[model samples]
Target: MPDLLGRKFTANEPNRVYVGDMYLPACDRGGKNMYLATVIDAYSRKLAGYALADHMRVSLVIDALAHAHGVRGSLDGAIFHSDRGSVYTSQAFRNYCSSLGVRQPMGAVGTSADNALAESFNAL
Candidate 1:
């Protein structure tokens, strides 16, 4: 994967580009943390899809993207930009993206600015 997004986070229309990422929320009274994966449409800056799980595995991200596909009805030529995390870079995730005809672009290593949209969302 390459940084195809080139740090540009805007899109001309919905599903043209999507920025997504996974985060771990604050632990609850049970001291258990939940992982959340989110997809935001760049054009509208709205939440297109999301998935929460007990673990931040590849399936978490996959399910998030799948939700986007279901909602939008198609994701054949969308760009999915995210940080270079293992869940995003895993072979399984890559294959899932390919299956949906979604291109995966990664942010630079250790560079949070490269994925500002999804990062800012997680901060909310």
Candidate 2:
């Protein structure tokens, strides 16, 4: 549980970071593969924030995080939790998080249960 607690504390930092992954359907306005957005608070059981896009590229993840931060504020030591999706694993997003002082922690690969917070949020 220490890891979870650490994530929370990291998120609570004055300008901490928050992270999550999103999945979009395989269809755009023109019927392309679209993914849904997924994000969560590392500390407050609150959903914190999220955004949607037609694509599941790293840009979508970055945009969602930007929306969350815009809603909440600065993110310094925020702990971002996510599955090992390529978008989340992308160098760009990881670099962005590092630049913002957010610790990027990937959920165990192939273990959706490990990210129950995100699963539960989606259900909500």
Candidate 2 per-residue lDDT, tens place, 1-124, comes to 1134322323443334444658654456776666677667645656666767776678888877877778877777677777778988899988887876777776667877666667666665
- Give per-model TM-scores: 0.94, 0.76
Candidate 2: global Cα-lDDT? Answer: 0.67
**What TM-score does candidate 2 get on C-alpha atoms?**
0.76
The models' CA-based lDDT, in order, is 0.91, 0.67
User: What lDDT tens digits, residue by residue, belong to model 1 across residues 4-117?
Assistant: 878789988788999998998775535677888999999999999999888878999999999999999889989999999999999999999999999999999999999999
Candidate 2 root-mean-square deviation in Å: 3.9
Which pairs of residues collide in model 1? none
lDDT of 1: 0.91
Output the number of the lDDT-best candidate.
1
CA RMSD of all predictions: 1.2, 3.9
